[model samples]
Target: MIDTDRTAAITAVLDSLADAWARGDGDAYGAHFTEDATYITFVGTRYQGRDDIAGSHNTLFAKFLKDTKLAHEVLDVRFLGADAAVVTTRGDTYKGEHPKKLTKVQTYTFVRQDGHWLVAAFHNTQRKPLMEAISFRFAPETKPKAWPAQLLDSVS
Candidate 1:
């Protein structure tokens, strides 16, 4: 059984990240990650270390991502051990109304460091509905059982 308190703590960290992004506070947003964290963006940009993450986000927030808000829903969380966990979430960045369906799937690897859970690595990938539909239709077994069927229904 998973420890409710630990799960809550980990979820809180994700919440904090979203909160920080909503405020466009790059430093606060990066604080949730470990000092040596690795972050891979949907566009394939790789950021190494918390400083790099914060610096790049500062630039993005000041320009491209200005005024954007992050929306995310946790899909699953699995513990690797007492001090490590992997969390999967669907998310998107929006300016006005929250997205009805998040377009990106993200995975975060979190580690307990100095009694606090911090993201050690993060990977984000944009979902391609058409491609998913084709794959699922051709090979039903390729579909992930945990994924909602609606994820590919739109393409069908």
Candidate 2:
């Protein structure tokens, strides 16, 4: 069974990651991963290692985005072992602009190493609400802006 403290720790890590991305703090964002972590984007592009991760962030942030909100609903968190966990979450990014493009639902897998929990793998998928929602209204509530908020947000 997962204790509250462990859960809090996990939450902290996830939050920091989001904060980093939202704030355009590449260092903070990359800090959440292991040295050789594997990151797979929603489009199937894979990047390995901290260097690649850092490079990706550098290239992304260098483009200049006014990063905004990153609100998510943590669907579930399950322990793979004493040092590993899988977190399933649904969320969307909102850029303060026009023609919204949102990608919902992201799954993250983290592993605790040497007393520190680091993300070992990350996989993001676009949420298909209408496909599962018989009552969901297909409405354009607002346009989405990829604000680069997928990086670290808050660790504690």
Candidate 3:
């Protein structure tokens, strides 16, 4: 059974996390994650435990990410059980220096602990461009041949 109340709570957690990131508040951002949480950045760097996640983010927020603005939207949330849920979010980061928008899809595994929802695991990956995303969904047999030779061979 899905609990709308729990889902709203989980969404609030994610919203708080994004707000903290935008404000460069590492402590507040880390508060949303559990003590043993695992965070994987879009660039594939893994941070284990809340302390490490907070520490690394603190450094970045003070330096490279100081002026970064973040916008996040909850794409979906699915309950695994009474105490567990999986959430998907779309995030866009804007920086004046970096004109190109950095968009990513973030998946979070949330678990209810001590009467509160906390992020247990998080993974962020870059979002594919519109055309690339659509093309990637094509069935293997329906995929376009990249080379002329391959096309000729397939026709024969």
Per-candidate TM equals 0.94, 0.73, 0.78
Residues 69-135, candidate 2, lDDT per residue (tens digit)? 4566676688887898888776665666522434466788889988989988888787554543332
Query: Is candidate 1 or 3 superior in lDDT?
Result: 1
User: Model 1 TM-score?
Assistant: 0.94
Top lDDT hit? 1
By TM-score, the best candidate is: 1
The alpha-carbon lDDT assigned to residue 113 of candidate 3 equals: 96
Q: Summarize candidate 1's per-residue lDDT along 12-65 as a digit string, tens digits.
A: 999999999989999999999899999999999999999999999988999999
Query: What are the Cα lDDT values of the candidates?
Result: 0.91, 0.70, 0.79
The deviation in Å at residue 88 for candidate 3 is 0.8
Count: clashes, candidate 1: 0
TM-score of 2: 0.73
By summed lDDT, the worst window of 10 consecutive residues in model 3 runs over 147-156
Give the count of colliding residue pairs in each prediction.
0, 17, 0
Candidate 1, clashing residue pairs?
A: none
Per-candidate RMSD vs. true structure? 1.6, 9.3, 8.3
